[model samples]
Target: MPYALYYWPTIQGRGEFVRLALEEAGVPYDDVARGPEPDGGVPAMLALIDGDSVPHPPFAPPFLRAGRLLIGQTATILLFLGDRHGLAPKTESGRLWVHQIQLTLADLVVEAHDTHHPIASSLYYEDQKPEAARRAESFRNERIPKFLGWCETVLERSGGPWLGGRRVTYADLSLFQAVEGLRFAFPKTMKRQERKSPRVVALRDAVAARPRIAAYLASERRIPFNQMGIFRHYPELDP
Candidate 1:
């Protein structure tokens, strides 16, 4: 049976991270939430959380359903998929290290999401512009460099090509997504900082060039980044 991925239909959001791994691994899966209601759409996604079919419900979207297993949380899902799809190292320590890297990336994703919804996720961007500006300023100045610099260091330690040494692991895919989101959300800042993180930039490019990943990105299956997604492009906040 093909794996079933449940996430919001419209935006890339956290779901995109899982999608990238599946694509890179050439795994055939059903993007459940993207289908029609009767065939598992938004209602199906909500049912997983609000209904009782799943004994262990996920608190939010981006959960993967594989046979009897239901996995939630972006990092956790990626860790599971990474091991199963050979997108992680063979050693236990290496897998844990990759999972640790993914957790740190998750931290970056949350901070980036907060750039627009700093005060409250319930509030609209227009309602929280001032606070968002402040949050975004700090993110652009401090957080972006810190996270990207750490990724660069990891790549340096790996001695090139991929985060898992010569192999392109899920961590590498997540890092590419992070770079893409950061660039879209903070083009000005990313452009200026890219000079300092050459390895990180190269990794992003390498991931983009992978056969399956490249095809998936070019296909309509890849959702575009928008205001509703985690990485929103607000010109005022970025500047």
Candidate 2:
């Protein structure tokens, strides 16, 4: 059976990470919320999180269903999908390294989300604007460089275009998503770091060039980064 991806409908959110990988690998997947019915979009997603179905439920959006396996956590789901779809390296060590990069990317993602909502996830950005300002400053000065530097190190150590070296993997997909998110959220910061992270940028461009990825990005299914998603484009937040 084909995999089923459960995620919020409107925003790309964490689910986009999984979507990018699937699209890149040309794997078949059904984005459940994108189906028919009222509230089948966001409300269905909310219900799954609120319901008692999976014994090991996800703490947030972007879970996957593959036969007997029900996997949550964006990184975990990607790792599984990558391996199953031949997008991952064959060696155990290589797979471990890929997972490491994915987890680090996940951390960067969380920080990016917090840049626009530093105080509480439940609260509106308007209510947390002051805190968001402070967090965004920290993100621009500290977090962005730190994360970019680590990715630079990974690229340097890997010795080329992809995170796992030579071949594209889940790590590269996640990193592409990270770069896209950061570009959406911190265009100025990304511009400054782009020169310093050539390998990272090359990988991003490579992922973007893949036929499936290129097509998906151009398609309407790909949501534009907005103020509501993890990567919010606030003019004041840039640079």
Candidate 3:
């Protein structure tokens, strides 16, 4: 059966990472909140989350319901899907390496999210813009380069068109998502250093150009990035 992806309806947010892999692999799954059927929208997502159908419930968005398995956490869900599907490398070492990359990507994502809400996730950006600004500065000046540099090193060592050598793995797709999110949120930083991260940028572009991914990107199904969600682009944050 196709997986049921539970997440917010409007923002790409964390769900975009899962969406990228599913789209690239051309996997048939319902993006639960964004589905065309009326029974498959936000209400459906809420019901699933609120229901007692499963013993282990996901704590947050971007969870996947595949058969009897109910999985949460972006990295964990991706790792599970990557292994069950062909999106991960077959070898144990390769799979472990991909999981490592995915986990690191998850860390980068949380940091990116916190840049706009450094004080607290529950607080509004307006409520903590000053703290957010402070965090953004550090992120732009230090965290961004450090994370990107590690990814660059990974790419360099992998000798890849993809993170896992020749094949397109979940790590590569997640990396593309991360690069996309960062570029959206930190365009100025990205423009300044993207050339230095050639392989990472290339992977982003390649993921974008994949037939299904490209189509989804162009389609109405793909949600646009906004001020809310993990990667918010503030002009001041960039400059």
Candidate 4:
């Protein structure tokens, strides 16, 4: 049976992380929400969240329904897929480390999203422009370097072109998404910091060059980054 992935049809968001892992592994899966409604579109995704058909329900979108199992949360889903698809290390300690890195990346994702939605997700970016400006300043000047620097350190420690030493892992894919999103949302900031994180930038480029990933990226299956997604581009916030 094909794996069923449920996420918003428009934006990549957190689901992109899971999608990257599946694509990199050459795993076959259905992007449920993107299909027609009769098949499994937005309604089907909402049903999974609201319906009582399953014993376990996800609190949000970007959940995966695999056979009899329903899994939620981006990091948890990646951990499950990583182990199953060989996107993570075989050893327990190594798996845990990859999960740890994924969770940290998740944190960074939230922070990046919050830069544009600093006041509240409910409020429009225009309504909270002042607050967002303040938030973006700190994020651009301090947080970006801190997170990217840490990733560079990890790559240096691994002594690799990939995050999991010699092998590519879900963590590497997630980092690639992060770099892409950051570049879209804060091109100026990322361009300035890219010099400091050569290994991290190289890893992003390396992931992009992978055959499956490269194809996925070029294909229509991979959604383009837009303002509605976690990483939104606003000229003022980035400046």
Candidate 5:
């Protein structure tokens, strides 16, 4: 059966990470929320989420359905897909190491989202402009460099090409997504930040150049960056 991926239609958010992995794995999957009704759409996702038929229920968007198993949490979903698709290492230690990198990218994603919604997700950016500015300023100056620098450090220590040394792990794809979002959310900041993170930037470039990834990125399936998504571009917030 094709993997069923449930996420918001409009926003890439955390779901994009899973999408990238699926795309890279060259596997067929239905982006449930983006499809037509009956078998697809947000209602279908909600049915699975809110319904009691399934033994496991997801708390929010970006869950995956693989046959009998229902997987939630972006990292956990990637872990499953990684093992199934050779997107992670063969050994337990290597797999855990890649998982650790993905979790770290998740941390950076949370920080990036919190920059615009520092006060609360329930509150709009307008409601938290001042707080967002304060948060964004710090993120631009400190967090982005720190997180990206750490990525560069990891890449350097891991030899050359790919985060987990020779293999192309799911974490590599995720790091590319993180950098892509950061570029969209903070283009100006990333311009300077990229100078210090050449390997990180290069990895992002390399990921983009992959045949499937490149096609996926160019296709209509790849949602454009917008204000509503996790990576929103507000001049005030970015300024």
Candidate 6:
């Protein structure tokens, strides 16, 4: 059976990270929530989150249903995909290292989202422009460089390309997504930051050039970055 992934249909959100792993692995899977509601949609996704029949209830969207197993959280889903699809190192230590990098990337994702919604998720960006401006300033001036520089350091210390070195892992794919989101939301900041972190940029470029990833990116299935998503581009926030 094809794996069924549950996430918000309209936005990539956290689900894109899981989707990247599935796509890069060349596996057949149903983007459940994106399908018609009668079969798969937000209602179907909510069944796993709020339904009484599910043995393992996920806290939110972006969970995966693989046969009898119900997996939640982006990191956990990616970990499963990495191991199952040879996207992670074979050695335990190497796998842990990549997982660690993924968690760090997750941290960066949260910070990026907060740049626009620093006050509350329920509040609109307009409601917290003042706080967001302050938060985004710090993120642009310090956080972006710190995160990108740290990623560069990790890759440089590794044996070769990829976080685990030589072989591409799910973490590498995720790092690419993170970089892309940052570039979309903070183009000016990233243009400056990329100069200081060429390796990270190179890795992002490399991931984009992968046959499967490239194909998926060009397809309609790939959602365009919009203001509604986690990575929103506000001229004021970015400036």
- lDDT of candidates 1 onward, in order: 0.92, 0.85, 0.86, 0.93, 0.93, 0.92
| List of clashing residue pairs for candidate 5 | none
Q: Provide the lDDT at 78 for model 3.
A: 84
Better of 3 and 5 by TM-score: 5
| Model 4 accuracy (lDDT, Cα) | 0.93
Which model is ahead, 2 or 4, in terms of lDDT? 4
State candidate 6's TM-score: 0.98
Per-residue lDDT of model 5, residues 196-227, tens digit only: 99999889999999999999999999999899
Compose the digit string of candidate 3's lDDT tens values, residues 160-210: 888888899988888888888888999989998798899889988888888
- Estimate candidate 3's RMSD in Å: 1.6
Cα TM-score per model? 0.98, 0.94, 0.94, 0.98, 0.98, 0.98
User: Any residue pairs clashing in model 3, and if so which?
Assistant: none
Candidate 3 structure, TM-score to reference: 0.94
- List the candidate 4 regions with Cα displacement exceeding 4 Å: none
Cα distance off (Å), candidate 6, residue 23: 0.4
Q: Residue-wise lDDT of candidate 1 within 1-239, one digit each (tens)?
A: 46999999999999999999999889899999889878778998898899967799999989999888999998888988988889999899889988889889999999999999999999899999999999999999999999999999998998878887888899999999999999999999999999999999999999999999999999999999898999999999877
Q: Report the alpha-carbon TM-score of model 5 versus the true structure.
A: 0.98
Each candidate: RMSD: 0.9, 1.7, 1.6, 0.9, 0.9, 0.8
Question: Which is better, 1 or 3, measured by TM-score?
Answer: 1
Using TM-score as the yardstick, the better of models 2 and 4 is 4
